[model samples]
Target: MGDLTMYRYDSYDQAIVDARVEEFRDQTQRRLAGQLTEDQFKPLRLMNGLYLQLHAYMLRVAIPYGTLSAAQMRVLGGIARKYDKGYGHFTTRQNLQYNWIKLSDAPDILAELAKVEMHAIQTSGNCIRNISSDQYAGVDAAEVADPRPWAELLRQWSTFHPEFTYLPRKFKIAVIAADEDRSAMRLHDIGLKLVSRDGVIGAEVYAGGGMGRTPMVAPLIRDFVTEDEIVAYLEACLRVYNRYGRRDNKYKARIKILVHEIGVEEYRRQVEEEFAHMRQQGLNPPVEELARIRAFFAPPAYETGLSDKIDRADPAFALWVDRNVAAHKAAGYAIVNISLKPQGGIPGDASAEQMELVADLADRYSLGEIRVTHAQNLVLPHVRKADLPAVWQALEEAGLAEANLDLITDIIACPGLDYCALANARAIPVAQKIAARFADPQRQRDLGELKLKISGCINACGHHHAGHIGILGVDRKGVENYQLLLGGSGAQDASLGQITGPGFSEDGVVEAIEKVTDIYLEQRQDGERFLDTYRRIGMKPFKEAIYG
Candidate 1:
């Protein structure tokens, strides 16, 4: 990954972050000594994105919209090799998590991150966290306008805001410039889609969508809103949630619960009322400021008229191109998706060496930029089509050239009991076993576009709720048990996975997954994906294959 075109830290931004680092350093010292209790220091540590995991501390650093520079990626590799383990995990939230951080080393990590005009602020706690957008924010032809500037605007305004510091629960916001929903906007607390109406640009807002023990697709809250008015409108929504969202039960604290319990119309009425009272108290940034921000995201100086010739003479390279290369707005260019899911490899774990390799590749071919996809893969967003062979060779040498982007082998699983203290069962091994069972690349290709997600616990960190074949790991009397879910998707045709029958043992779960897929293989009509078949048949055959 590389620099975010033009957005860099200013003096004010740097000063604020630098001072916060010192403040946290002192707080850490006090907690280490005997001055502060764990209860008192828990929120303090979380406010800085440091979490106590199973065996060690985990530090989650925000990579805003999953965009990074080559220099920043290099620094990240250095941090991983120098501070924690020799690797880091890119999460579904578009952030990076080092799973083996030490309490004492956390400050130094923050210091190193500050040098890159980045910080861990608002990466945690019950505040507006990182605002993610389409990885192809500015470059997508389907986009009305680049969403990165607005994402940055939200990040700046929400960072350490005093008014909404202590909400009922944590909130997430996602903005998408592309016509299609790539960032899972409907699954966030607030989702904004930039739209054009008769040459005028506005936003279509969605609220109360989320995934956990319960998953709900976000419903449209606003048909259209002026760009300038979005900030005020969002504030009104947040204010309503901050005040009235349930706090009695931790599980029921999310805005999705609030929306479900009160109904969308009632919630909309409250937000509208709130907006009427305080719609313009320095809420929206001036139009000039937005224009200034947009200038930073102007197209990079890509070599124009690059030959669209690709060396498909190599069959391996051709398969990689078909699976990993995506359509680009510009002619002679393609978006390259670097699969981190190399066969049975972890979904998003990248070694320090691999990170360095990606940095070098981005520098050489992708205009010094990389984008992290929500599906736990990396993207060389602006690679020239003619350079595909060279880039493929480089990535192949680095073990990142897996041609299974949307295949069943691309399993998304959280680092369950292997790393997290909150997990009830192991996630990584189950993912590994299932991947190994379907190891044949040709077999995976046959099962086209099947999303298999796994979660170690009911928290749904692995996004299993959105998987076409979802697996949830639970504990029954000290034994790891797995539950199967059918027909979920995170795309434009969003739907939640439904539970099928009862549970299975660890090994049994893998076999059961195979049976379900086998049924799909047998019953699927021509050109139909597993999701399509499951939807058409209503999951009865798959349920019978697993339980009957």
Candidate 2:
């Protein structure tokens, strides 16, 4: 049980799970034979996180550690073209969905995903879905090391783990190695940060956090847990959540609600007891296995002593470096963020042609590697300084070279009411209008890095609660009303945004944002970010600037 073999399969061995395809097909046929009703078939679908939303069924496919090959992306593209409406949506939790999928075709779709070493297992269920990490984990300069292999290890252990599959609500886990948590760890059911204390690597664990009807930020349960005890401690926390978490009401079912009700101290005590029990049973994964997992994530062969030449040559590239690139463990290389929100284009919607272009760029410049970020962008993790201009040129031809990374125009928005049945108002159109309003490159650069996030509904799928300026769209009467929230962040110092004032109509929302930005520009201290300025001056000036 302490070995990697204890887990079902690794990435290379996942193709073997395709044998379950025939089993699922048989199950589907049985259900259609009047043998299984909605109740009987519900558990099976729950295993896959396939839920029947208001109008149609949605299929969520787990993307282990948020890493995908070009071949896998092509398979997803094919699924979108054939099974869906020629489009697929990537979620904030590092999963992808096909909204228009028919229930009858789900089995076949799962079979197809299995061929590509993917599945929907526990994606929508009470069990753990995909384990996510920073999209630029290994490559980011801010990282101590890549957290992907650890995430991959957790993914294998949690996939269909028998003990905690019947939890009251869904669970999510996020790991981050960045100095400023790019993975949005605070908003997850369990958040892990890699840390070294006294020359020993371990994790700082946070638990009982999530968003929905009742949003909550996770509390730190342990300052550090040794590498060998990670899995056992996680299991202990889940057990505590499973046994005591409220299930009578769906609103109170999340671990967050339970933590709130009992208090974090009591919850911590309970988890400690469970951890002690598991430790006594020798259920902790072995140290050798941890090392084995680490071996898979060894750093790529990089040329030594490469110069930071790109920073000197192009002022535009320097701006990109200052805003988009994070500190990497390796010298002469950087993690480059490819912003999907280019000017008036849709946020996170990559056309098939665009996807192909990215694949080509990945092969040519980035060692055939590309990662889809949780913020609805792409990452070229291992780019050298010298090759950046060539990569930029290729991206420009593909219409993927909008250099507004971390600027005001690089907004994170969901598909919103136009597509999502859960949405009250359209999110994409609002994001488009905002981007259009600030389309001037000089204006955006002057404003600096301001993170604006919007969600179509209260589910917070678009991560509005964590934005520097968060917008949550609501329906008031027949029209759409947008609420403005200020001073929130998703990085290491995570905080939920506070409401600034009353909601605004769709036509007035962009003006309100402009008003806020104008206030920041006028009053901000030198080198102060939008968040830092708001933190120092409070929201009164902003409120007055916008309302008065």
Candidate 3:
């Protein structure tokens, strides 16, 4: 058993080995028996990232590599229906959480998850969470190649990694295959961008970036690390973070804080030293093992010679292409974004019926594959060029086709006060108002691509920090007031939005966004995006236009 080179499970292989399940089950029983109180049980629960938030107990399940079969999705649905309130929330890091689970059912839930080849191992600990990649990794036109296999390799290596299980704070890792980052790599603890130089694949690494009370974009550490050295290099980065990251104050404990306090250059040097030591110890996975992992993610059988023909006459398809569809590596197919926002519908909220519909669409038109995007949207990754019309029809029927992926109407919003007790104000109503204001299809098309994100609180659930136009709802004197921020993005060139003047009332925020948009339309250069124009003109012009 010790000699086995690869650790990935096959169909017949036991998931928990019976002993591990019994161990966790025993721990649960002990906690219930009063051998441990909430304080002692908290750490053990956090080892799984299970937390009793303001309103409910949340169970975060790790989805390694963000890849799941239809059967697995059904299992997740079952769990959600059984333990939670018939719905689960998909997080930015490619994981799902049931927010209303009972403490007594947690162990049984874990055991249920194990039955479907899944677990929450290392999801909440100081150790690494699930390693995420571009949701459209294999399907995107701009990708050098799919980065899923490499992500899988890291997932296997990092799971139950002994040295990292006791790090000072949580760690996140993201990999991007496309030239432009679809994974929001810059906003993660560690970012890896695949690059090809002289016919050899390597990774460009970034370290110590995160979003929280203090948001910091990751800084570049190494321009390139060869594929063979990835594990060794990652070990070095983890060592640096674990050793130097603060433990005294929870607020000052993330790797981002350490990176900022010590400077990127110093952090890089420390990581290099750690990497060298790991290399000396020969802990790196061999090339053959990497190849074996890669085999599981082999490209699906794609039809030859797919065409990118645009039907200029079809306004609906044109609108879809202009907003929802992204460039694909294949000639005939497109990476389609299935908007969860249907006018006033909840962002990223997919009902059980909707999930089944999506699964059916995946089977019919998209080669049986679906991806949950970081932007609170879903992706039909491999939809054939000719099948787009049918796919759109099905999506429309299911209320999943909004045709407003990146426009002002396609607002990314958190659950807010309506559902989440942590929220200070209502996010859904604000988002609905903004969408209604810019509901005109022609006006939205003319306005072009704009990213608007909203969060009910500073925890940044909606990724407000990454939006081109960010809206943060705050409570003052028991009243809701929203703060506006300009010039933020979640792509390769990510920058936190700058706050604009004073906050607005719930009724005033939509007008504020409109005023900002009007200013952009006036000052924007030919064919410039909202972020581009905001960057070129700065916030002064927008502030003057909105508040003047």
| Best model number under lDDT | 1
Model 3 per-residue lDDT at 514: 88
lDDT by residue (tens digit), candidate 3, 375-473: 767787777878888888788788887888778887888878876767888888998888888889888878888989899998787888888999898
Predicted structure 3: clash tally: 4
Residue 531 alpha-carbon offset, candidate 2, angstroms: 0.9
The TM-score measured for candidate 3 stands at: 0.92
Clashing pairs in 1: 1-69, 1-70, 2-68, 2-69, 2-70, 3-69
Regions more than 4 Å wrong, model 2: 1-16, 27-43, 49-56, 305-307, 311-323
Q: Quote the positional error of residue 417 for candidate 3 in Å.
A: 3.6
Task: State in Å the error of residue 219, model 1.
Answer: 1.0
Report the CA-based lDDT of candidate 3 relative to the real structure: 0.81
Candidate 2: residue pairs that collide: 49-124, 140-327, 141-327, 141-328, 142-327
Q: Write the per-residue lDDT of candidate 2 for residues 1-548, one digit (tens) a residue.
A: 01111123465556545655566677677887878898988777767657676557888887776776665677787888888877677777777777788878989899888876778876777778689888876776666666876787787678668887778988899988757887889889999998888987789999877766677889999999987899999999999999988889877888888888999999999999999999999997777876787776676677798987674466765566666665556688777777788777888766666666776766666666678788878887777877777877777777777878877788888778876778898898999999999998889989887889999999888888889999999999988999999998887878888888999988788999999999899889999999999999999999998789
| Order of the predicted models by lDDT, top scorer first | 1, 3, 2
Q: Using Cα atoms with residue i matched to residue i, what is each candidate's TM-score against the true structure?
A: 0.98, 0.92, 0.92
In candidate 3, where is summed lDDT lowest over 10 consecutive residues?
1-10
Against the unseen true structure, what C-alpha lDDT does each candidate score? 0.88, 0.80, 0.81
Cα lDDT tens digits, model 1, 353-444, are 99999998989988888888788888999899998999999999989999999798888888899999989999999988988999898998
Local lDDT at 245 for model 2: 83
